[model samples]
Target: MKKLLLVLAALLVAACAHAPAQSAKEAGAKTERNFSPAHVKEVIVKGKTTQKEILAKIGTPNSVKRRSLGVTTGPAEVWNYWTAPPLNDVAKGGLQPVTSLAVVFDDNGVVQDYAAADSSVLIQ
Candidate 1:
């Protein structure tokens, strides 16, 4: 009876370990949906871009904020993108993936300084 109990306990531990790992992988895949680095680069690197052009190309940003032009901060426009958690696994702890792209426009409303948030979260 002792040996049988020990064997059963070992099997239960092994099964539990494998179960949690699959959940982690599923969480990671859920986060991957909203992240698109390629799309971000394409919009920023191109020459002579206007706000209207950016809107047309990438569609509407997730959010936007405006700032005044200054020495350290010449005109600021922030754009955000996000992906929600998967529907079936709502109980699991998963972050809503978010990326922000900031575009500073010159007086003429052309892109002056374009910056993107560090995408390390998505890469992992």
Candidate 2:
């Protein structure tokens, strides 16, 4: 009986250790609004997009900011999105993951530049 119990416990531990990590897709499926990393990457890396195009593609940004009213500067737009950390690290006290997508547009409303920032330490 002791040996059988030990074997079952070992198997349970091994099974959990080898389980696949939960991705953002799995967690976000339960929410009303969810944007995957791939979706965010597509817009930021693609060329010459507009505000309407962005909204149609990635939904509304989490937040938006405009340049100072009087300052003469190129018009720009920024978008922010966040995802929960993978399950493997959540129990280990990992930081909640976030992704920021910034799309800068010229005064004429043409995509001038774009950037994506991730909270993963490995990315930096």
Candidate 3:
């Protein structure tokens, strides 16, 4: 009976210790950040940059997603960057100043296209 009680206690401790680290890692995966348009433009080059280059230029991604394209179009990847602080409005949520940039890459891992909105891109 004492041995059985000891085993049960060990199991309880193991379960409690196992899950919190995984949850914490998931929580840190998404980042609400202010990215600079100039910095992005300087590092990103269409038909030239690769995934490794991107990681070298920018730090960890807020998140990463995989996408599949049809056979003819070829698979593509998209990365998102925000040029302003993340906002959570209590009421009347509206855009005051925000910038978003997306970089697309073909299966070759070369930058294929990019798009940016807002005057933030005008910054040098």
Candidate 4:
């Protein structure tokens, strides 16, 4: 049994070793890094954009949440994305405030509201 387990582990490691590496564009590893306070304004707009548009602008969200609230007049879908400087930029002695953006969509996937929280939680 121990030998079987070892063989399985070896196979797993070999499979992982052969997997293709992720490229920067495919990874979207903070390609739009080091956003200023005004950057969110330029990207996200409430009641005028759709979830599809947001995805196109921001690539992929870190998370997506959906809930059916009993309330009749609020968002039912939420998409979250985080912004921070790349390591190189951070090493240059610049301030990189980590910010989280939550975009809420109605039943129809149209953006209803959005909020950005900084290390200081700048609600706009």
Candidate 5:
């Protein structure tokens, strides 16, 4: 009886641990965001574009984070935008494909740098 109880307890703990990952996977599988790389390139410029300009041109970012640039530059803000394949594709997938853009801004709210990645190309 004690051995059986121990096994049941372990199984319960494993189920609890797995619940969050399953939830996250389901969430990702349902996410849909889309944007054009050409538009981003035309509007966002390093050392010139301000946060407000980006907002006006591209709309709101999906996420924002505050992070350290380096010891010399101190902290900076990062804005992230992304485009992902449809939920149907993601749900059927081995690896989910996405296109993403990250914009870094200085303390003065001017863009410092930006990068974009398109994983859809890899699948094609």
Candidate 6:
């Protein structure tokens, strides 16, 4: 029984070794989505856009958090939508592209500020 298990494990490893590697474009495709940073920014208007508008344009966020903006501003709500490389790809080493959007809203539920980032390009 032990020998049979060992043979099966060895075969599995051999198969994996012969598997073709994923192309760079294929890796990026894994993280790419319908919406992008520019799309999010276009849909959102700081101090003008409301939470409902954001939901209508971009759909639900991946996460929501509440925190203090400053001593004067008190608290605010933040919505984040993130698309990052898979953990398995990162585990293999090297930088992986990440695209995300964060929207901050005041107590009135109107967008106060927003930022988007894409790590596909490196700045000089």
lDDT of each: 0.51, 0.55, 0.57, 0.63, 0.66, 0.66
Query: Model 3: residues >4 Å from true position, as ranges?
Result: 1-34, 63-65, 69-75, 83-95, 119-124
Worst 10 residues of 6 by lDDT: 10-19
**Residue-level error in angstroms, candidate 3, position 87:** 5.5
Summing lDDT over every window of 10 consecutive residues in candidate 2, give the lowest-scoring window.
82-91
What are the models' TM-scores? 0.46, 0.49, 0.50, 0.54, 0.58, 0.56
Model 3: lDDT to the true structure: 0.57
Clashes of each: 1, 0, 0, 0, 0, 0
Q: Among these predicted structures, which one has the highest lDDT?
A: 6
Per-residue lDDT for 1-124 in model 4, tens only? 5434444554564444342456877666536542234666788677788877776666556667887557666568887766544434434433455677778898888888887777732211
Candidate 5 ranges with C-alpha deviation above 4 Å: 1-35, 68-72, 94-97, 121-124
Between candidates 2 and 4, which one is better according to TM-score?
A: 4
Give the alpha carbon lDDT tens digit for every residue of 1-124 in model 3: 5434434554564444342233666557635333467767777888898978875566444444457444447446777654332222212234345576777778777888877666521111
Regions of model 1 farther than 4 Å from truth? 1-35, 68-73, 84-90, 94-97, 117-124
Clashing pairs in 2: none
Per-residue accuracy of model 5 over 1-124 as CA lDDT, tens digit each? 5434444554564444332233665565643334467767888778999999887676567677886446446437888876544435533545556677888998899999888776752221
- Candidate ranking under lDDT, highest first, comes to 6, 5, 4, 3, 2, 1
Task: Tell me the tens digit of each residue's lDDT in model 6 across 4-119.
Answer: 44445545644443424567985555543434777876788778999988876775576778874564464378888765454354344455676778888988899988888886
Of 4 and 6, the candidate ranking higher by lDDT: 6
C-alpha positional error of residue 13 in candidate 2 after TM-score superposition, expressed in Å: 37
Error of 3 at 73 (Å): 1.1
Residue 54 CA displacement from its true place in model 6, Å: 1.2
Ranking by TM-score: 5, 6, 4, 3, 2, 1
